[model samples]
Target: MYAPTPESTGSSVDDRPAVERLRHGDRDALTELYQRHGASVYWNAYGVLRSRPDAEEMTADAFLTLWTRRREVQLYGVSVLPWLIVTVKNLSRNRLRANQRRTADSLDAADPPSARASAEELAALDEAMALVREVVDRLPAVDQEIFRLCLVEELTYKEAAAALGLKHGSVRNRLSRMRTRLQSELGPRS
Candidate 1:
């Protein structure tokens, strides 16, 4: 996933007047704004959702609701990015609910690893995790650094940025893309 570059704007990037026009059924303005910020919205959705299809769907749903509620919605501020992020979060929650409805799901129990798991099972799980680490280490050096800083050290993006000499946004975008690539390489779960 590509990170959005800062756009050159004399006024605030998300001017209130621009938002008012969009809220008043200005289709062209809506289209323009969507084009300008779609990538950021997608990345925000991807951060929460961790699925391309889910992120895409959440992005679509967010904009659709923005369009649908145009007249009724109030644009209170200039930071449309925050609004879009909040909207995507809400949509992701909805998507998660729908997904939960389809699957037998729970967050209650913490079953220990199988008590009867043999030495073979422990060895296999260890081998699988080691293989995952090897694959991670084989990635581009920047990816390896980002994974280590975030996962191994549990650094927030800002901290990772300072440690690795990368922008926080770049760290976020790289991690998002890395998760998708890893999921694809791993194939479907049993």
Candidate 2:
């Protein structure tokens, strides 16, 4: 269900004019854009974040970013929907990562690591990690870079592609294959 707005006529609308107005500092244009796309943007953020408050906040942030960076905003095929979706996704991911870090810090502070792991347990963990490292190191240089950029750095595929000067599909496919290879290599042995 969507909120009833005068602009929400359930018909495809071109975003170029609104974007141009936004570029020229028209607040009404920004409002029109929001009325047109706010629900979709909020839902996209909610799909990623699963928290209503966070989704709402992210939606607002995405629009704010759109307004602030209007001069630099790029449109794909006369539509701002793609850019808005990507913004919401990135913002939601950042919020989730931040929340995770805060939760981890609080847990660490609350539960000091006074209890030490046994030497055997530590050795096993080290050996498992070393095996993983070896598996990763065996990948091709490009795959390794993909792994580092996508998994370790937590960048979206598009961001990774831009950083590496590769196509989005190439980065996505390589990462998929890399994940499968890693899983197969690290899975329990018969």
Candidate 3:
């Protein structure tokens, strides 16, 4: 059986060696550092973005930041985990905000307020449903489901929350955000 030692109990001792190596511009040392704290950084990004590919990219960017900023970083307690987590969070937010900007720009709610679709355009529920699907699909997965349930399906907020294993307030809030996005895209209702 393996036994714990002073070295095995904490990150302080183990991390110092890798940090020292990083100070020397050693790629292997950066790899070691990533292996140690990569999951924490990835989780930080994933928790914010909720997408695997984005999280993976965020993790890589965080480690790259660590390598680029190695000489500038002061490791007060011998671990770079905190710095990595902060980097992950900042990058993830930037990516998410950029995506929102793209979505908002793509919306192009620029038609004159008085403009209206022709009766031929409104001949079928299929057209309206397709439009709703296009807007809702732009949201994140959880938000898409919540909006579909609470709005499209006409489920009560409480019922949707229960069905989706979320709090009532959470369901309500997401629905509110969904409404805001649609309002911005389609303009205020008459």
What digit string (tens of lDDT, one per residue) describes model 1 on residues 102-153? 4533354445666467899889889778867877977886687678657654
Taken over the whole model, the C-alpha lDDT of each candidate is 0.69, 0.79, 0.73
Full ranking by TM-score: 2, 3, 1
Task: Give the local distance difference test score of model 3.
Answer: 0.73
TM-score of each: 0.48, 0.55, 0.51
What lDDT tens digits, residue by residue, belong to model 2 across residues 8-53? 5323678999999999999898998888889889999999889999
Ten contiguous residues with the weakest lDDT in model 2? 2-11
* Residue pairs whose backbone atoms clash in candidate 3: none
188: Cα error in model 1, Å: 43
Identify the runs in model 3 with alpha carbons over 4 angstroms from their true place: 1-13, 109-190
Error of 2 at 190 (Å): 72
In model 3, state the lDDT of residue 102: 58
Model 2 lDDT, residue 42, Cα:
95
